[model samples]
Target: MSTSFTHIFNGDSTAEAYAHSGLEGQEFVWREMVVQGPSKGIPGQESFFGPRRTYFQKELGMSAESYYSLTEEEWHRMAGASRRGEWVLWYEYDVFCQFNLIALLAGIHYWDNPPDRLSLICVGEDENHRWNTLANFSPDQYPKLLDTRKGLTHDDLLYAATVWEAFIQKAPLGLLPFAQTPHPSFPYLGLAIGYYLRQFPQAHNGLNTLEDILLQEIAQSPKTQPQLIRQVLLQRNHPFGFGDLQWMWYMKKLQPLWLQEDDHLSLTNLGKKVLEGDTVYREHLAGRHFGGATALDYIWEEDREEIRPFPEK
Candidate 1:
C-alpha cells in the first residue's frame, strides 16, 4: 500500500517537476490563478472571476478561455483535498506565490472543517543561492524538502486572511500599516508588501520599480529584449513571478521611450531624463493598473510620496 499525500503547487512548472519526482500515490493540484488581476477577494460570496476574465481579455489581450479553463476545477480539487488527505502547499517566497498562498489560506478558512494535516514547503534560497524556485531544483532535492515541511498553524491562516482582505480592498493604502508590522507566522509578508508598494509609480521618476530596473539595465548596456529581461530576472531579489508575456506587455507600454535599433533596445533622451529624475513619466506615459475592486489611473506624487488617482476627465 502506497502512502498518499495531496500536493498543491503554486504553478504549472513546479507541479510538472513534482509529477516526475517519483513520489508515489500523490494527488497533485496546481493553483493556476493569478491574483495580480482585478479582484474583490470575494471568491465564494459572488462571482469575481467574470470581471477578471474580461480584464485579461480586454486589457491584457490574453485569451480568456485559454487562461481560465481549469481554474475552477483546480480550486475545487484543492478544497476537496483538505477534507480527506495530508495536504502540502508548495510555494515560493515571492510576491506572486505569497499572494496566492494568502488567498488559498483565506479560502481554506471558510471550510467547515479544514484539513487534518496541513504542511507547507516554501523555498526562497538554496545552499548555492542560485536556485530561487522549486522548479529549478533537482528531483533528489524534493525528498529533502518534503522531509522538512512545517505544519501550518491557526495564526498563519489568520494572518493570511488579514492580508488577503487588504489586497482585495479598493484602496491599497490599507496595506501600509500591515507592511510596517511584522508577523511571526509570515516572515516575508512585510518585504513582499514593500515590493507591492513599489509596483505603484515611483514619485520621482514616475516609473514603477520593474520599469526603472528595465530602463536602468538597458541604459547601462544596450541589449536585445530577451537578454535584458534575463538580466533583470537574474538581478531581482524579490521576483513577482512575472513571465515573458507580462514582461513583453510592459516593454510594449514603454516602447515610446525606447529606440529599437536592429535587434537591440536603448533609451531615448526622454527616457534618460525620466531615469535621472529630471522629468516625470507618468504625466505623458501613465497607464492603467487594476487593484482588486478598483480600476485606477494613477500617478505617484513626488512631493507627497504617495500614489494619487488621476483627475477625472
Candidate 2:
C-alpha cells in the first residue's frame, strides 16, 4: 500500500494526460486558485471581458487582414485551460496577499540576495528558525517604508533557500517538458532530480543498490516501465512505434538512468545524488544509482492538487 503525491497545474491538459496514461488505480483530486481578475468599464460591468482587442492590435500593429486571421477560439481555449488551474486569483490590490507573501519569501531565497523592489522583499530569515516577519504587520507599524512586516533572518533565509530550491525542483516541467526548441528538458530534469535528493536527506549514502532505488520510485508512482515509456511518447506527440525513437532516448537512456544490465532498470549512486539534490544533467552522466531510493522524478501543479506531500512548513 504505497501512496504517491502529485500537483497538476490546472491550466493545461495535465488531467487528461494522466487520465490517459494507462497507470492503474491512480487516485486524483482537483482544486482551483485564481490568478487574474476581470476587466473593467463595460456595459455589463463584467470583469471577465478584456477592455478591447484594440490594445493588442495597436501593440502588434496588425492590419485589418491580419486581425481577422487570428483564431480567437483556439487562442481562447488555450488561455482558458491554463487559467482554470490557478490556486489564487489576484488583482492589482492586496486581497490575496499571503501567497504573494510566500512567493516573495521564495524569490528572496531563490536569488540569494535582497531584492531591488521593496514590495517583493517582505520575507526574511536567520540561522535559528525562519519567520514570516511580514505575516502580521499592519500599515501603522512602519510608516517609513509605508509597508508593514519585516524580512526573514539569516538562518531563516538559509533554511528557506534550501526549501525553495526543493520546491521548484519538484514542480512539473510544464511547457519546458514539451519545448522542442531550446531543449530545456535536460536541465529541468537535473533540477528535479537534485531536489528529490534534497527532499530525502536520509538516502544520502544508500547508493550501493541502484535497482532498489529505481524500484522505489516506480513503487511510489505505481507505474511500470512500459507505461512510463508510453506516457512520455504520448506527451511528445510522437508515433507509438514498436521501437522507433524509443531506442534512442526512452528505453536505454532514461531507463538506464535508474536500472542496470544485471537485472531491470535500477537506481545508482549517481541517481541517488541527483535525487538527493546534488544536481546532475543527462549529458554529464557519470555515476548513477537506482533502487528503493529513487524518488518521484517529475511533478506538475495539477497533479499536486490531488496528491500533496506532507505540509512541511
- Pick the lDDT winner: 1
Per-residue CA lDDT of model 2 for 1-313, tens digit only, reads 5422222222123334434444323222121111111112211112212322332344334443443334233223322332211121111112122222222234334343332222212222234643323223343332322222232354444443333333333332222222223211111222222222322212223221222233345434545566554544343321111122312332343343465443334455665565654643343222221111113332112212222222222
Model number with the top TM-score: 1
Q: Once superposed on the true structure, which residue ranges of model 1 sit more than 4 Å away at CA?
A: 1-3, 25-35, 44-46, 125-131, 283-287, 293-313
Local lDDT at 89 for model 2: 16
Model 1: residue 43 alpha-carbon error in angstroms: 3.6
In model 1, the Cα lDDT at residue 186 comes to 65
Q: How accurate is candidate 2 locally (lDDT)?
A: 0.29
Q: What TM-score does model 2 achieve against the real structure?
A: 0.20
Q: Report the alpha-carbon TM-score of model 1 versus the true structure.
A: 0.85
